[model samples]
Target chain A: MSRHVIGVLVENQPGVLNRVSGLFSRRGFNIDSISVGVTERSDVSRMTLTLDGDEKVLEQLTKHLNKLPDVIKVTHLDAGCVERGLALVKVDVSSPESRSEVMQVADVFRGAVIDVSRDTVTVEVTGTEDKIQAMLDLLREHGIKEVARTGVAAMARGPKYTGTE
Target chain B: MRNGCDVVLESFDAEGVDTVFGYPGGAIINLYDTLYDADLNHVLTRHEQAAAHAADGYARATGEVGVCLSTSGPGATNLVTGIATAHMDSVPILAVTGQVPTGMIGNDAFQEADVTGITMPITKHNYLVQDADELPGVMREAFFLANTGRPGPVVVDLPKDVQTAETDVEYPSVDDVKRGIRGYSPTYGGHPRQVKRAAEAISGADRPVVYAGGGVIASGASRELRRLAEITGAPVTTTLMGLGAFDERDPLSLGMLGMHGTKAANYAVTESDLLIAVGARFDDRVTGKLDAFAPNATVIHIDVDPAEISKNVEAHVPIVGDAGDVLGELNSTLEEMAVRDGSEWREKVKRWKREYPLDYEESDDVIKPQSVVEAINQHSPEDTVIATEVGQCQMWAAQFFDYTKPRSLVSSGGLGTMGYGFPAAIGAQVGRPGATVWDVAGDGSLQMNIQELATVALNDIPVKVAILNNGYLGMVRQWQELFFGERYSSTDLDQVPDFARVAESYGVKGVTVERPSEVEDAVREALEHDGPVVLDFRVAREENVFPMVPAGAAINEILEG
Candidate 1:
């Protein structure tokens, strides 16, 4: 019943993402959030997925994920891992006071004001999920008009990725 | 200049493919015409779906990449079930579908379907050829990917125009084609440390059992598996897909395990301390009551695919390599180690075998399904390749037959697809020139793809189809009798058209064996026939495949007949 994030390095091929997600659903594993992006190796892509399940099922899921042809490696990136998420939030600012309040909150959260209009302000925030969620909750007080979120992408922490690390 | 369709024919020759199971249509007319000039042999199946199953049977029987082809739209879509069956069971096959034309691909023109889009999920890889020049590479890649690693189905969607379009590009050599898939190298040898761990587990265990599956056959590891088992003196229990991978007559054999599995096999698996699973996936059916499967075993899973190691049941020593290669290495390690006394475990399993042996009532009027299978086992050659359609017939064939050689038994283990046997038997007979191939089918299931009888007759394949005619979808009927208040719904087949008559209509020999006394004689007659023959054994309508775990029930909670 707890959320766990897993980073998977897979071949950069068409429908590899679908295979990963399809394996999840077919095995009755519940996915919370999923994100994928090109890694340093253009031939390979990294998939960060969040799922809620018991440890046994999660272990089984990892094994199933590893079974796909395009999948190269899978690692649970919860500890000693640099995890981040991005969100673009538009806040309704009818009045100048509310707009200033929104900017003040964004500044405190280290979120940049990416776009500004007469009626609304859009903020770009990126950080660990906790940071993004806390900033979004604060922005909600100013009347959130829209929100778009990318799932967490993760990698091992620090300078080394060798077996010793 | 040679057209793209001729390139397809040349590519088949380049891959050493001698036979193709396919159905021709408008989109593939050019490819069919090209076949007439080429030396490639084609077994024209009655339906596209039969072509797919036949191809699967060919793969299972010959251990070669099976090939099937169909035209656009309905023809391509018809291969969905068969393709999925091959995919789920990891049978290597190349399914070529003809597209409407490059110009009309997405236009929804006559007989146009998104062949690639539809097969994307099922295939190991798929290609919708946008250019005729890429056809050679795509075709080669399809075969390479289909047969490599955890072998499964691959699709090549050639648009009609692409087949007709002239191509000057020469066909790629096998080496060049193998190079097409750069990232698809499969590990044939396991990590040395893991192999040692597995060997140590095998030597130290008092109750060791070898759980073999189709991967053994896929890797051609049956000889290695038998040697490994003999070295450790462990009883071997094969999964349904693993039938014929080991000698069933040997004292070390525990027969098939899981739902409808032998009591001794299931008990051995449940009680064993060390379960060495070779190329077995621990499927839901095999691991009934998954949590309780091999409850006390320290599983050592050896498979070619790394992903399968701990997917279902956790393996203490997960060795990823070809089954034959892994076992070969393990055998070397075990040879240096001391053998343990397994007489206690062997004796206990022997007692179980004696206590609850697979038995059925000998009836004079109605032919027992088990008895029919036994007669087939008794009469058929040791190398006979038996293909079964789904239902009581499949379970009975798996249980009763004495499979002594690899690739001697082929059935739909994963998808449990019905109507698979006749076409599969046809394919097996074609793949293995003179070997006896039998389609052990039920009345209900045989009717699903019965049209393939024409293919058998036309090809003069000499395949023997032993239809266990129970007049019901026997497995479903068993369920209905057990749980659904005995209401015989659509399960009642009523034997319309009569399978024997249907066989005769196809210009093949057909016989109806109603009495138990006729069973052996009918089987003999079928075997003696120079061409294709069908034996419809009218079995007990109420007969059920026993030792069922009752769906979610644990393997230990099986109800023995």
Candidate 2:
């Protein structure tokens, strides 16, 4: 199965998120990750869903999503679209050497040290999923403590937009 | 300034809704008070589930949006099964529910429930109205959503405060409501290219079968379906929900198809080279063993719901549009093509029909359920509407009834909810007062909603109920006998109350028939009665519906008795 990202525009109303997520669970469609936020129009909200499925499954998923009354539009983001995810990773730095090493790794990835305690440091990273995963892999030796991630957010590369009038 | 309850009634009037089935409760008391002076007819069902089912029945019979109302919490919860049944069958129904006061909504107030959340999966759309001004618009949108493309149930939950909250907002016109819901435009016409391809597929096939379903009836496309069948000279088979979409008495008709489907219909579908599916989803019940179903047939599926096009079985040419419009296009397109002659295929289907006709053994000691069905069909008027509780009785009704028009057969097809028929028959009788309405019920299924007998007797609905009393949950017993080594379990309902006496207790006429000879006469007498009547036929206890395709087996794997 190939991984795919779908962008959906829906009415900004109560229980709209439950409607979308409930549909996926009920239909037995596995959701890898999903992110929702306000769009350019206040009345419309945008949701980015990342999932793994073959062509037919993707088509069916889109069709099912389109059937929701609150959904304004659903578009599959292809390779031309830019996708990004944000992650905040906390790592234990037992020594000064380890702190420098972690700092070096974060520097290479252009991650900001958002917080620093006596024994640990929190690094804020934002990039494509692959970049964030690579940074996390390097931080594993530093004894990762906790990580919070914002699922993939995608937008078409060109002037094309999914918006309600 | 008008209250929200006034807006609800005005919206109903604007939508041309004449009847609503519901029971008044604390949260919904204000709406009931508003209804007191309204000209609309409100059927006071014994239970909330019965009210929902009755509304569903009204929708199925009249092809309009059926409406039901209930109070908060338990009242709304009780409508779950009925709503799910309508959802599964794509029946258009609007469920209006009253919630606790807005301030106490999430504070664990008395009779409070998150009804909108509970009904999200089962409804086409729903709204928890917060402001009284939105009441008028929500009502219009709710009714529109319920009856529109791929119709299903819609819920509008109004908090008790909202019902009494006064607002100056006027009920919107139909166009205003349409403009508000911009995301719900349904495709009514099939793509021209796909229609052409479907026509080509139909014309090129050597063996073809027209498989119609409830969508045909929903779209009022029976005439178009008949035209397509005649133009192609293909035999027509229907899903249980599709009964009456094509006249069963027609020479080209192959009764019902699927689990309890006729042998000839199953055989025809298995061998056909082309399967033209119109407004019918390839449900698991209809397509037993999906990988092996219609193995050789190139499928052309026409349905209004895009999700249903290739949901189960892949369609070679999928036409996403209303059945009537798509079928109309297909017929016109086929008229231009050089169609294949299906005379040989027709003859083969006819031979199958002749060789495997539905039959049951004659018994003198007890009545045969099939004979009871035949008696009802023979005695009832041609235009009689036959509703049925789910199980062997439902299948028998579908099998034996001579349905010549759409909406003549109203049974729970998808959800298979027992106790659906009795209340549904009341709704049908209310919807079509001039036509005879019969609920052919199983003993166990009838008892599920037997309390509706009070509804019938009180309303004076002239609905005739014929009970096939087998002293067991007959369908489950059949499965147990066939698949579970006859372990019986809880299926043998030996303590079933005498249905005739039950009807009499409700102030309705009741009759009990034990002999086969009495079946027809009892049905005639019940029809001749001016009020509601229940006829209980003590059918053979172990009678099993035959030509059954065991669950998960291929359709061709028929089990004949």
Candidate 3:
């Protein structure tokens, strides 16, 4: 029942996401979220997956994943890290007062104004899962229109590094 | 100077590796690019999971550290199950994946995923490369960790930029590499006193039985196990995971004891006066009721893993060491001591086998799994390599197949991973091409990696696949029928693909059998084919694997056929 977040470093290529996700599915592992993107290295990519299993299962899974030919490195991220996700929430700006209230709430969370229309305003918030939830909660009072959220992605905090393989 | 991926590969080649299996993905593209022109060769699998299993099979077959590659996100995650399988089976393998570049790592950048943190618990050791310079050392260290100690899988995660970045390469020799796992040495020979005690116990017992397991094969102690059995004149019963450790046809053999085991096998375990358990974990499936299991017996256990000692059934004498080495010492000690034959005990076991022999009804209306297995035995070569997937087929393989050579029967015994047979057969074929390799799988298990037929075709490996197509998750269905009043739920696989078409799609020849008479002909044709082939036989679905002891029931409570 121990949950874990694994930070994976890989080369950017097609079908990689499916390959990783399918693995979890086939083994009947419950994966909460998987976030992927390009990194500072244009050719490389990073993915963070949150999954839960026992110590023995985790040990076996990690070793098996490392054996893949395309994988460059797989790191099980430590909990002592600043983990975060990005989300965009669109609120119904039916009135001028509603738009102002939304702006005030976004400002409180340090969220940026991404898009706006006569009847709607989209605020992009980047922070910890709790922070994003807070912003979403505040905006929900103003009648939420739509939301798109990037799944949780994390990294170690401070000068600490997982180290390169 | 070397990038992370280049550094990893160079280190692997230095480690004397020639082959790796993987699938390319966003995060791992850079590594594949570097590997393409590198001295190391890579087998591009359709799925990352298959790559991991292939590596596992390679490791199991060759005793070499197998390697696999995948990209970030799903690519990295896909290798998890395969890695877990290898770990459970104690196979050595290395999985490498590429990660997002340093700056955009957690920005939800396209195709980025954290592999290392996800795989921590599944691997022996895992490394995430934050610096390019450490790549070579990490790869070397990964290999060392994988192959040494209690051999298992290790992981290395590399960032893309780091792989392409320049760094000085410092390759470490095999002997120079340092490993972190403690007390993991595969060769832990037991002390002399332990052997003497074990020998004395064996000699003194009136009704002794040698319970052999895969440890005998892993320790290369099959010959020693045989010698011990012959010297003591004790009949041997095996765990499901221990099949083929002793010759199945040997007169002293009691096939697969415990739950779902032969009645004679189970009875022998419970009735024996002394139980010599070797290289076995005393798994619940084997013990059934730990309290009642071998209740009348004085147990002497020998295993490589110390943790396994006294973890399940309490042992009167526990010796932790390599099964072969310790058994060898025990054999020498027995030769020196005055040990008498237990003819009465042997006769009792023989009587048990005769009284409740393993049997299955076969009529013209249905193709029973037992009949299929018997046909396989009738047709297979003397040194045939038969790999079975888990469930009914695996049990049948254990019961029916006569394995004269060690490693002749490869199956997911401990882990019981479904779809293990096909990839393992390919690996076995690669290891021993002269031996006739057959992947005998049930329909439920075969579909797990049915796509591996393409691997066979692509690699030109002529391993034959025998599908016991019972149109259901046979084992689970059988359990439901026997225990759950036959209220089948999601057990029936009515939506199975046309196996022939599926095989043809992969460019492999496919043969179908509807009658029992056609079984031999289909198998023979597949064996004769110059390339990979699949023989799908429509076996009866309701056929239960017999001689089953209900979970936690005493060994004596075996339900016979």
- The per-candidate TM-score of the B chain, in the order shown, comes to 0.98, 0.99, 0.94
* Candidate 3 chain B lDDT trough over 10 residues, lowest sum: B178-187
Per lDDT, the best of the predicted structures is 2
Write model 1 residue lDDT over B327-436, tens digit each, in one string. 99999999999979899888998899889878887888878889989998899876689999998899999989998999998899999999988888888888997798
First chain of candidate 1, TM-score: 0.93
Which is the winner by lDDT between candidate 2 and candidate 3? Answer: 2
Question: Which residue pairs collide in model 1, if any?
Answer: none
**Sequence-dependent TM-score of model 1:** 0.93
Fnat per candidate: 0.13, 0.70, 0.00
| lDDT tens per residue, model 2, A1-165 | 999999999989889999999999999999999999998888889999999999999999999999998998999996789999999999999876888888889999999999998899899999999999999999998899999999999999989877675
- DockQ score for model 3: 0.02
Where model 2 places Cα greater than 4 Å from the true spot, the runs are none
Candidate lDDT scores, in order, read: 0.87, 0.93, 0.79
Task: Supply the DockQ value of model 2.
Answer: 0.84
- For model 3 the local lDDT of residue B429 reads 73
Q: How high is each candidate's TM-score?
A: 0.93, 0.99, 0.75
**Lowest summed lDDT over 10 consecutive residues: which window, candidate 1 chain B?**
B177-186
lDDT of 3 at A27: 57
Best-first order by TM-score? 2, 1, 3
Which residues of candidate 1, in runs, are more than 4 Å off? A1-17, A36-84, A152-165, B166-182
Q: Which residue pairs clash within candidate 2?
A: none
Candidate 2 has a TM-score of 0.99
Model 3, range B407-501, lDDT digits (tens) per residue?
Answer: 77777766678878887777667766687888888888989888887888898888888888888898888888888999899989989877888
